[model samples]
Target chain A: MAIEIVQCGALITAALLMIIGLVALVYLDNVLKKIIGAAFIGDGVNLLIIALGYRVNGIPYIFLQNMDVNSFLGQASYPLPFALVLTSIVIGASTLAVMLALAVVLYKRNGTLSATALLNDKKLGEENNE
Target chain B: MDGTIFIPLMVVIPIICAVLVNLLHEHSGVTKIFGYIGAICLPIVPILAVYGNHFFGGYQPLANGGLTVALPEAANAIISGSFLELFHPAITYAFGPGQQVILFVLGLVAMCAVFISIAETKKTSGVYLYMLFMLSAALMAFVLTDDIFNLYVFFEIAALVQVGLILVSRVRGNYETGLKYMLLGEVGGSFMLLGIALILGLTGNVNISDIVMMIHTGLVNPTNPVLLFAAGMLIYGWLYATGLPPFNAIKSEIYSKGLPSGSMLLQSFSVIACISIGLVIIRIFGYLPTAQMAMLAVSVIAMILGICMAMVQDDYKRIIAYLAVGELGYIGVGLGLATPLSITAGLFQAVNELVVTSFLFIGFGLVLYKTRTSKISKLGGLVEYMPVAALLTVLAGFAMAGVPPFNVFQSKYLLCQAAIAAGIPELAVIMIILSIVTFLAFLKMAYAIFLRPKPDELEVSSASVPKTTMAVMIVFLIICLIIGLFPGLVVDKLGVLALTAFAL
Candidate 1:
């Protein structure tokens, strides 16, 4: 029962991470903070995907020479979602790197990391473009 | 010697060429040859390859044979006849008539974009060409892949390549725009992934065909709230990808920021993404009238917002940008209608818009090339400088506005019929009014640029338009005319795909 609660808790944490990340991305004034917020969203997604593949007291998803097939099938927990999450993590990290690189460039050009200062313009008004 | 080998070649050739071109950036002559070689192959491979499925890693689906052959005997005995036996373990790419035509059009546009970009510059940057090729490859994957997760990977690739294309443009404030787009895109991308995860968690398979099969077989409940939520999330990503509604303003900004060459490719990407992702949505959620209605409602909103926004813009680039974004709604309308005829019309519109919008971008590109300004207030009387180009530009504008004897006309006529047939005549009326508004907006920009007297202060470049640009425009116009004259040549083939996918 306790383990089941922990498993469910992981899902709740994943949802909370996503919500907090989105709020930071939208409400934060600093551009760097917004990027960090984006990163948090990615981390949240990765966690959610991981939660899907989690198995309580399950064996590794590998076949052993002496193992019983039925037991393996019942106890091996899903490995597909883990493989998926791994790829997502790599893609997420690379994309975050690119975003950070762009943030650095924008800061150098405008000398400010504030989203308002960096993206403000006549064409890019707060109403829509921003 | 399998003919389907060309299917993978279609994507592989460009990727290999991207690397080659990137490495050979210092060698102008060598890069140009590689660039042309890769561009020519884009359309050719799709045409030559026979329609079939390619299973990556030779992992054929075990669904037909049951788990009896694939899984261990004990495991097979355990799940015996359950849905677990029907899961597809392989990555599949199915190429058919619809894919062939769509990829062919995308390749044509990409080829032209590459040709013009290389010709317009005295010394073309290999890095720019590499980005172009990579973007095309990603889009081709999106169009061809049967797995939704594969779609997400290529979606990210196309998005990143688009940012690289914009940053290379050196336009004022491009970096800022690029950063803004990326931030928003991260949100969209994450949600899309979450949706895919939900589908995986529910269905235990990422292959679209397998999921559809499970739902049809009554193995998975189609009315699950989680599935509905997933559909909603996927549609949000589709909106971002295709530049519909809330994303339209930024999507148009992306166009305005890109040079005409890159914008041409970018718009084509949105059109193709609309067809590919929209097809996935309908295939998965077609049973839900609410999902269909949602697509219809959002499309109507996009149409009104796009033209309204275009009408207020003085910069010709932004005007065309918004117009391009707005026209995407028509495609959504066709997809949203979820009927055989409507899907065909929607797809036909996608093909037509791909050609006409690129034509306009390249046409107006000449004005920018010659006058160094895209603002209508400062620009006037371009017809005198390049009569042939201006004439072609005007015709392209007419084509975009659904004028008769043009490609968009046939598609729009069908769309109206679809709206009426689907018991939504009000949508037909709205579309007709929006068509008129689209024409007027284009007319405003056209009259100002080509017919109005040249501005006293505007300095036009004495340099003539490039032959390559003119040649590419003439080719696109020919294609538009061909399709406009005999819509059957394309529509008949596309109808098969619509019938198969929209049969639900």
Candidate 2:
């Protein structure tokens, strides 16, 4: 019952994180906040994945000497989610690195981090004649 | 031979090559030798792949498909004893009937572009590392898998590497362009992930073949919204990756900022990834009427927006960038038509566009070298100062305009047949109008930049055209000629496979 409760708590946490991310994406005026929302979504996804991988009362999946096959099959800790989480983390980190580098460049070029400001700059020369 | 091993190795080899090249890049002589070696060796696996398909029927080059080959008893025992959950336990390399041949040709040409870029750059930088790495990852992800999630992972990796390469060039204005690309591209990636998550939840599996089988087995709802969402995410991702209309802002910026040779590789990688994913999504999810409608909508937007935007661009590279985006739409529309002729025309155009762009961009790069500017207005009377460069540029320009005796012309003609056959003669008319617009734009640019009297600000370079530059141009030109003269050589090989795959 406690294990079930913990699983419920995880789901709730994941939902909360996701909702906050969506709201942030929808309402945030600042570009940096949107980025933070993006990160929040990534975090929420990771948490949800871990929650799905959760096995009640499941110990580490190490195969011990003389391990009983029946017991293992019945309640083996799920390792697939763990592996997936790790891969997703690596991918997320690389993406973050590239994003940060780009953000820095954008800031340098336009002197602002606001998307609207940047869009305006993109339209800089076109406004004169038309 | 083993799918489990070969699939990952395709991504790994180029990574290893990138590392080695980066280490040796400081040594000019060593870098040259290593680049040549890498270029020559890169195509062997693809060559072997073609032969492998013939010898071992239905064997995909990489082992991740649903079909599995049983491991030898001994090896199985060892793995079983070790309690190792092999990520890939037994090789289940499944290549859809004739995908191997089409993938092989695309892979060969992509590698060819990389070799040509390496030869042209003549400078030691991180660019080559990113170039080879991006190409390898793109092709590996493209050819080796029938899995949707794996495709997403590889696509993200390739996008990162290509963005890195675009930034590596110290050319003016690329930094801003690269950032815009990164922001917008990650949004696309996130959508793809969202789609994958929903699909996994709905289908209980991540493998595309498993999902396809499940659909056939009645275990999956063909009209599930989750499946529709997944298809939508992937198509959007491809659009952003390929630089189509809605996402054209970022792609145009990057192409306008990066060097021409680099842009050639970037363009090919983006287009191939788009077409591959676009085709796969159409194949796997075409059962859904909504999915087909959605794809048709994206194709229309991309086609209309691409050429219209191309008609208005002032910068030479931006014009090419818009056309590249537009051309991808044409390919997308062909894929959408889902006819044998259309699919073949799309694939044929893909290969031709890649080849034709190489010459035009290289010619423009050479012109940039001679004139030191990319703006059409600033470039004038190149005929007097650099006759050879101007002549080649004109030929490339004509090819882009779809003139006769060029590969693009043949491909475009087939695309027209495809449109008309699909009962979209209006689209055929639009295509012809766009071709005319492209011709007029190129003619204006050519006359303004190359044929007219020299602008005082345009400086002719004291140095002669590098042998390597000329060689790259000649090589691409010859490829265009070969494809143009005998379209069947490529079409005969790739057409049937594309038709079979897209036919469902």
Worst 10 residues of 2 chain A by lDDT: A121-130
Index of the highest-DockQ prediction: 1
Interface DockQ of each model: 0.49, 0.33
- Top candidate when judged by lDDT against the true structure: 1
In the range B1-504, model 1's lDDT, one tens digit per residue, is: 889988888889999989999999999999999999999999999999989988777666554543334668887676567765555677788899988888898899999999999999999789999999999999899888989999998888888989999999987778888888898889989999999999998988899988888777777899999999999999989999998988998899899889888999899889989999899999988888888888888888988999998998888888889999889999999999999999999999998999999999999999999998878899898899999999999889999999988999999999999999999999999999999989988888889999999989999999999999999999989998999999998898788878767543
Cα deviation in Å at residue B458, candidate 1?
0.8
Q: Which residue pairs overlap in candidate 2's backbone?
A: B3-B63, B67-B92, B68-B92
Model 2 chain B poorest ten-residue lDDT run: B83-92
TM-score of chain B of 1: 0.97
Each candidate's chain B TM-score? 0.97, 0.87
Compared with the true structure, model 1 gives a TM-score of: 0.97
Candidate 1: segments with Cα more than 4 A from true spot: A121-130, B63-71, B76-86
TM-scores vs. true structure, each candidate: 0.97, 0.86
lDDT tens readout by residue for model 2, B1-504: 554334344455666666777787777666666666655555555544422222123443232242256654453554453413212322233343245444554555555656656665657554465566566656655665666666777777777777777777676555555655666666677667666666666765665655565665567787776677677877777777777767875676666566675777677776677667777776677676566566666767876787777677667777777777777777777777777788888878877776777677778887777766667777788888778778888888888778888889998999999889888898889888888887887888889888988878768888788776787677777777888888887778667657645442
What local lDDT score does residue B277 receive in model 1, on the 0 to 100 scale?
A: 89
